[model samples]
Target chain A: MEKVVLGNHAVSYGVLVSRVQTISAYPITPQTLIVERLSEMVADGELDAIFTKVESEHSALASAIGSSSVGARAFTATSSQGLALMHEMIHWASGARLPIVLANVNRAMAPGWNIWTDQNDSLSCRDTGWMQIYCQNNQEVLDSIIMGYKVSEQVLLPTMVCLDAFVLSHTAENVDIPEVKLVDKYLPPYKLEIKMDIDDPHSFGALSSPENYMEFRYKMQEAMDKAEDIIIKEGKEFEKIFGRKYGMVEEYRTEGAEIILVATATIASTAKASIDSLRAKGINIGLLRLRVFRPFPVKDVVRVLLNKKKAIVIDRNISYGKSGIFFDEIKGAFYNIEGDKPKIFGYIAGLGGRDVTPEAISDMVDDAMRKDKPEKDIIWSGVKL
Target chain B: MIEILIHGRGGQGGVKASLSLASAAAKAGKHVQSFPEFGVERRGAPVKAFNRISDEPIVIRSKIYNPDHVVVLDPTLIQSINITEGLKKGGWIIINTDKNPGDFKEFCKNYKVATINAKEIALRNRLGSRAAPIVNTAILGAVIKVLKVSDKESLAIAIKEFVPVKREENVKAAYEAYDEVVFEGEV
Candidate 1:
C-alpha cells in the first residue's frame, strides 16, 4: 500500500512483511519507534512473532543471536549509545554467522548528549563484518530491510540497514510498502543448514587461539566477499518480482558530469534536489548514492565515479583524526588500478544532528572544485563554535 | 517556504502534529521538511519542532528563528517558555487553550492569534482530555482555514493517515475549533 510513513515505521513494516520470526530490542532514541511499532503489530495480531523486551541494547542483539542460532529469522534495532553498547555483540553476531538483520538509525556519539542524525553511530561499526546498507528515504528503509534479509541469509552474515537518525528517521515521506503476498514470494522463511541439536551438541562462540584465529578470520572475509555476488543476484531477482531495482550503488544524473558528490541516506535525497537546482543553472554535477557500503562495491565505484576529474565525498560521519572512512576505502580500491583515481576530497557534514543544508553542500562542492583544498584529507562543512 | 514552529511537551503528539502538517501541505502540492529539536528525550519536557513547506525544495537549514505560523499544543509551555520569540510580524498563532481569545490578545500582540478550548472538544468527543494531545488535529483544521494554503479536504486526508478510527471526532473537533476560535482578522 502507498502511504506517507516515517523511516522507523517503514522498517517495522518491512520486518512485518518479511515475516521476521523474532524481534528483540531495548528502547533508545531515534530507534525506539521501530520496536514500538513492531510491538503494536504483534499486539494487534497483524504479525505473529516473539517480541522480546530486552534490558539493554546488548541483550537485544544477544537475544536475536540466540534465535538465529536456533535457525530462526531474528531482528533488532538501536542507535548511538545503544549501538555502542552492542559493539561487543556486533562482532559476536557476525563471527557466529547468525544472519541477523538489524536496523541501525544513525546518531551522534555523546560527550555532549545529542539526539540528531549522523552516520557516526553506524560508521563506527563498519569493521564488524556486517554488510551495511544506507537508505535515502522511508521507502528505501523498507526496501533495504527486505534486501538485508536476503543478502544476509545467503552469506550467513549479519547486515545493518542504516538510515540517518532524524533526517530519514522522523521525516515523513510517501513509501510504497510491498504487499504481504509479494514479499512472501520474494523472501521465503529462512532455512538454516546448521542448527543446535541436543543429540549432537556443539559449542558456539568458543575462544580462538593464535593458531586457528587467522584462518577463522580469513573464512569470515571470504564469506563477506561472496556476499557481493549473492546480493547482486538477490537484488536482480527481487527487481524481477517487484518493480524496483537496487544495485550495489545508485547513480543519479551522473552521466557527463564534471563534478560529483558521493552520498548516502537523506544526503543523497538532498544532493538530488541540489543537482536539479544546479542543473537548471547550467552546472554539470551529479550524485552517486552508496547503498551497499560494506563488502565495498569496488567495480561500481570505478565504473560510475573513477572517470570523473573531481569527486567529493560528503561524509555525515567522520573517523576523527583520520579522513572519511569511505574516502579511505575508495582510495584503497583505486590504488592498484591504473590511471588517475578521481581526486576524491572528503567533506564531513551533519555531525551531532547538525543540518546539512543545500547551501552547505554547495559550499563543499565550491571548495572541492578548486584546484587546491586547504585540507587535503577530511573537510568540515557548516561547523560553528 | 512557509515555516511553522510547533511548541509542546515530549509526549503531546508534537512530532505527529508536525508530520501531519507536512504531509497535509505536501498533498497540497508543496515540498515539506519537518524536524524536531529537543533536550530531554523523555515524555514531558519543553520541546519544539519545525516544518518548512514550499512550492520548491526547502533549502533553509537553520532552526526556525522566525516562524510564519505557530501551533502551541500545550498551553503551559507558553508561560514556561517564550513561545513567541521568533514569530514573524503578521504571522498567525494558534493556541490550544481553554481561555478566550480576548484573554490571550495581550500576550499575542503584534501577530494574529486564535484560541480554542481543545481540551473541551477532546472531552466532548470522548477522546479523553488528558493534556488534550489530539488537539493538534483540531488546530490543523483551523490552520487550514486561516492560512488558506491547505484546504479542509487535504487536512482531512492528513488526519485520516494519522488518526483513522477517530476520524469523525477529529474532523468535528477541527470544525468546531474553526467555528468558535476567533482569528485576528475575519477570513
Candidate 2:
C-alpha cells in the first residue's frame, strides 16, 4: 500500500519486506528512528525476526556477522560515529563473504559532536569490500535495501545503502510499499550455497598462510566480479514484481549534452533540478546518479562520459589530504579507456552538514563549463573562513 | 521560490514547522524540500531548520542564506542569535510573542513583520503547554494567509497530516494566530 513516510522508516519497512531473520542496532541520532521502528515491529509481531539490542555499534555488526555465519539473513544500521566504531567488523563481515545488509544514515563525524548529514562517514569505508548504494530520496532508500539484499545474497558480500541522515532520514515523502505477498514473491527465503555447518563442524576464520591466502583472496574477487551481473538480473526481477528497476547507475538527460555531472544521495535530486533548469536556458548539461558505489560501475561511468566534453563531480565528503573520493575512482576508470576522456572537475561541497542550494550547483556547473584548460584537480564550493 | 528559516528550541517543534511548511507547499503541487539543520546533540540549544518551495524541483543543497521568510518561535532567541541575518529585501517575518508587531519592529527593519501571541492561542486551543512554543501550525496559517499562494485545502491537508489526532486544537490555534498576525497593520 502507498503511504507517506520518513526515509528512515522506509529503510525499516524494507527490512520488514525483505523478511530479515536477524536484526541488531544501537541508537544514534537520525538513525535512531530506524531501529526504534524495527524494534516496535518486532514487539508487535508484525516482523518475525530475532531483534538484538546491542550495547555498542561494534557489537551490533559483530552480532549480525555471527547470525549470518549461522546461515540467517541478518540486518543492522548505524550512522557516522557508530559506523566508525564498526570499522573492524565491516572488514570481518565482507572478508567472510556474508550477504548481510546494513543501512547507514550518513552523518558528519564530529570532534565537535555534530549529528548532521554528510558522506564522509560512509566514504571512509570505500575499501571494505562491502557493496554500498547511496540513495537520493525515501523511495530509493527503501528500494535499494531490498535490492541490496537480493544482490548481496547472490554475491555473498555485505551491502550498505547510504541515506543522507536528516535530509532523507527525518523528512517524510510519499512511498509505495509493496505488499508482503509481492515481496515474498520477489525475494525467496535466504538459501545459502555455502555456510558453516554445526553438524559438519568446519573451521571458520582460520589463519591463512601465503600459499592458500592468495587463492582465497582470488575467490573473493571472483565473487565481487560476479556481483555485477547478479545485481542487474535481480534489479530486472525487482522491476517485474515491484514495477521499479534500478541499475548500478542512472543517466538523467545525458544524451547530446556536452557536460555531465555525477553525484549520489539527495544531492542527485538537486543536480537533477539544476540540469532541468539549465536545460530550459539552452545549456547542454546532464546528470549521472550513481546507485552502486562498490564494485564501482567503472565501465558504465567511463562509457557514459566518453563523448561528453566536460564532467563535473560534486563530492559531499573529502578524503582528508587527497582529492575528492569519487573523483579519484572515476579518473582511475578512465585511465585505460581508448577515447578522449572528459575533462573532470571535482567540487567538494556540503561537508560538515553545509547546505547545497540549487544556485550553488548552477554556479559550480557554470564554473566547470568555463574551464579554459582540461586538468585533473578538485575545488571546494561554498567554503568560508 | 520562497525559502523559510525557522528558529526555535529543540523541543519547540522547529523541525515540525519546516516539515509542515513543506507539506503545505507539496500539497499545492509545488516542488519542495525541507530539512532540519539542528542536531539533537543537546536539548534546549538554539535550533534551526529550513524549507525551500518552488514550482520546480530544487537542486542546490546549500542551506538557506537569505530567506524570503523567517519564523521565530521564541522571542528570547532574538537576543541569543542574529535572527535577521540574510533576510531578503521586503521579506516577511513572523514572530510568536505577546509583544505586538510594533515592539518587534524595534528590532526588525527593512522588511514586513507579523507578530502574534501564538503561545496564548495554542494554550487556549488546548494544544497543551509543551507544544506552546511550537506555534508552527498557527504561524503556518499566517504564512499562508499572507503569501496567498497556498490553497485553503492545502493548509487543511497539511494540518491533518501533521496534527492528525489533535485536528480541532491545531485548526483553532491556526485560526487564532491568523487573526492576530498583522501583515501591514497593528496587532
Candidate 3:
C-alpha cells in the first residue's frame, strides 16, 4: 500500500517490513521520528522487536552490536552529533563483522548549534569499514534498508543508509510499501553459524596479537571487495521482485553528452530540474548521481566519466582544509589514469541547510562553462566570501 | 506543476497543513511533495511550509520559491511577514479571516483573493480552544475550493487521516469552509 509519510517514517516502515529483531536508538533531532515510529510499532505489538531505549548514542549502537552478535538482525539510527558520539562503536561494529543496519539522518555537525541537513556527518565516517548508501528520495531510503541488510549479511559487513536531514527526514512524500511476503522471500531470517552461545561460551574480539591481527584485517578488506558485486547482484534481484531498478549510480540523459553533473543525495534530485532547463538552453549537460558511497563505485564512476569532456561535481559537505568530500573521492578514483580524463570541477553548496535551488544549480553550470579549469581545488557556492 | 506556500506560526499545524494538502492532492491522483522550512521552532514564531502538486512526477527536491498560490492560516501573520514573497500574479491568496476579502485586495492586488472565517468555523466545530483555534484544516478546505485541486471528499479523507485529534470535527470544519468559501471579486 502507498501512503503519504514523512521520510523518517519511511525508514520506520522499512524496518518493520525487514522484520528486524532488535531496535535501539537515542532521541536526536531529525532522527527522533524514525525511532519513535519503530517504538510505537514494537509497543503496539506490530513488530516483535526489542526496543532498547538507551541513554546515549554510544550505548544505542553498542546494544545493537550486542544483539547482532547473538544472531539477531539489529537496527539503530542517529543524526549529526549523535552519530559523532557513536564514532568508537562505528569501528567496533564493523571490526566485529556483524551485519547491523543503521539509518543516519545526515545533519551538519555543530559548533554553531545548527540542526539542518548536510552530508558532512556521514562523510566523516568514510573509513569506518561499513557499507554506506546515500538515498535521493524516501522510496530509496526504504529500499536501501532492505537491500543493505541483504548484501551486508552475505558479506558480513555493517550497512549505513543515509538521507539528508529534514530535506528527507521531515518531508512528506508518497512511498509504496513493499509486500511483507516479498521482503521475507528476498531476505530470510538471520542465522549466524558463529555466534556467542549461552551453552558454549566463546570469547569474541579478544586481544589480537600482531601474529593474527593482519589476517583479520586482510579478511575484512576481502569482504569489502566482494560487497561491490553482491550489491549489484542483490540490486538486480530486488528489481526483479520489487520492480524498481537501482544501481551503483543512476545516469540521466548522459549518452553523447559533453558535460556531466555529478551530485549525491537529494541535491541530485534537484539537479535534474536544472538539467532539464540546461537542456532547453541547448547545453549538452546530463546528470550522474552517486548512490552507493562506499565500496565506492570507482569502476563505474571512472567508466562513466571517461568520454565526457568536463564534469561538474557538487558536494554539500567539505573536508576542513581539503576539497569537498565527494570531490576528493571522485578525483582520487582517476588518480592512476594516464589517458585523457574529464577535468572535474568541485563546487561545494548547501552546507548548513542552505537552499540549493534549481536556479542556484543553473548558476553553477554557467560558472562552469566560463572556466576551462577551476582556479581552485574547491569553490564554495553562495558563500559570503 | 502547481506549487502552494503556506504561512502560519509554529505550534499551529502549519507543517501539517502542507502535508494534508499534499495528501489530498495525492488522493486526487496527482504526484505531490510537501516540506517545511526547517527552523529553530518555537511557538508563535513565523513558519513556512510548501507543497508541489503535478500530474507528472515532481522531480525538483528544493525549496519552493515562486509558488502559484498562498494559504494563510493566521491573519495576524500578515503584520510580521510578507505573505506574498514569491506568489505569482492571477493566483489565489486564500486567507483565514473574519474580515471582508476586499480588505485584503489593497495588499493582495492582481490576484484572486479568498477569505474564510476558519477560526470561527473551527471554534464552532470545537476543533480547538477559543484562545487558539485549529484553522489549518479549515483553511485547506477554502484552498481546495479556490484552487479546485481536490474535492470535499478528498479533503475529508485527507483530514481524517492526518489530523491527530478531533478528526470528525476537523472533517466537518473543512466541509463547511468548502461550502462557505468567499471570493472578493472576479479575477
Identify the candidate with maximal DockQ. Answer: 3
Candidate 3 runs further than 4 Å off:
B184-187
Q: State, as a TM-score between 0 and 1, how close model 1 is to the true structure.
A: 0.85
Which DockQ values do the candidates obtain, in the order shown?
Answer: 0.25, 0.34, 0.79
Ranking by TM-score: 3, 2, 1
lDDT of 2 by residue, A1-385 (tens): 6555778999999999999999997999879999999999999999999999999999999999999998899999999999999999999999999999999999999987778888889988988889889988788888888888888888889999999877789766556788888888878889876678877788889999998988977877888888888888888998898888788898999988888999888788878878989999999888998888888898789878997888899998888777888887888899888988788888988887777878888999888877864465679898986
Q: How many residue pairs clash in each candidate?
A: 0, 11, 0
lDDT (10s digit) by residue, model 2, range B1-187: 7888888887778777777777777777776767777455357888888887778655555567888878888888989998888988777788888876677655456877887777877777767675444476877787777765466567767788777568867877786666677766532
TM-score of chain B of each: 0.88, 0.89, 0.95
Q: What is model 1's DockQ versus the real complex?
A: 0.25
Docking class of 2: acceptable
Give the CA lDDT, 0 to 100, for residue A257 in model 1.
Answer: 91
Error of 3 at A40 (Å): 0.7
lDDT of 2 at B28: 79
Predicted model with the maximum TM-score: 3
**lDDT per model vs. reference:** 0.82, 0.83, 0.91
The Cα RMSD across the true interface for model 1 is 3.7
TM for every model, in the order presented, reads 0.85, 0.86, 0.98
Question: In candidate 1, what are the lDDT values of residues B1-187, reduced to their tens digit?
Answer: 7888989888777887787877788778777777777335477887887888888755344456789988898898877988888889878888888776678766556877887777777777766556444677777766777776677777778877777578888878777766776665675
